[model samples]
Target: SQTIHQWPATLVQPVGSPLSLECTVEGTSNPNLYWYRQAAGRGLQLLFYSVGIGQISSEVPQNLSASRPQDRQFILSSKKLLLSDSGFYLCAWGGDTEAFFGQGTRLTVV
Candidate 1:
């Protein structure tokens, strides 16, 4: 049974602060990993993705970055946060056509 875990479930941060969010998977190997952001009343937007360890692709350029160091571990980071960076961040894993998501992290940038 494959499962994804992300945390902290919620966060509140001030502008210009550094950020780090982590996600890990179990029961799968070399699975595709993705980072997505969903703004209020908006749809999910892909932020980054990785096919394997040390292989990452950015879907958007902003105050966000992603990394895959282990086969099942993905991390999202930022040097400085922005007000627009506040949103629901989700980590997902899958391949081909379908993906499964984490519970998501709600970040509030003040």
Candidate 2:
């Protein structure tokens, strides 16, 4: 069985601060990893994705960056967070057809 975990389910940060969020998967190897953000009433936007370790593709360029340091670990980081960076961040992994999402991390910037 495969499962994903994320920390600090909710966070409130001041604008212009740094941000780091981590996600890890268990019971899978070399699975495709993806980072997505969902805004209020908006569709999900892919931020980054990795096909393997040390291989990442950025779908959108903003105040965010992603890295894959291990086979099943993905990290999202921001050097200086902006007010617009606030949203629901999700980590997912799947194959050619389906993907599973984490509970998601809700970030609120003020």
Candidate 3:
């Protein structure tokens, strides 16, 4: 069975701190990967995505970046955090038309 694992169900970070969040999909290879952030009641916003290893695309210009270091793993990172960066981060995997999301990580920046 394919599953996505995202860590640190919740995180608290002071402003200007670095951040790294990882996600991996098991039982699947070369699946399309995505990173999304949801703020309060707003809809999920696509942050980044990958079609293959070493192939990453950013959906928005922000304080975050993503990388596909392996076929089934994706990482989101930031050199410095901003107060506006606080939100729920999610990792997902799927194909052209369907996507499966992991349990998101809620980030709080102070």
Q: What is the TM-score of each candidate against the true structure?
A: 0.97, 0.96, 0.97
**Model 2 global lDDT (CA atoms, 0 to 1):** 0.93
- Of the candidates numbered 1 and 2, which has the greater TM-score value? 1
Which TM-score value belongs to model 1? 0.97
lDDT of 2 by residue, 1-110 (tens): 99999877999999989999999999999999999999984799999999999999999778899999999999999998899999999999988899999889999999
**Which regions in candidate 1 have their CA more than 4 angstroms from the true location?**
none
Clash totals, every prediction: 0, 0, 0
Worst 10-residue lDDT window for candidate 3 reads 40-49
Model 3: per-residue Cα lDDT at residue 103: 98
Q: Any residue pairs clashing in model 2, and if so which?
A: none
Residues forming the 10-long window of minimal summed lDDT in candidate 1: 59-68
Q: State how far residue 45 of model 1 sits from its true place (Å).
A: 0.3
What would the per-residue lDDT of candidate 1 be over residues 20-99, giving only the tens digit for each residue?
99999999989999999999958999999999999999988898888898999999999999999999999999988999
Candidate 2, RMSD to the unseen true structure: 0.8
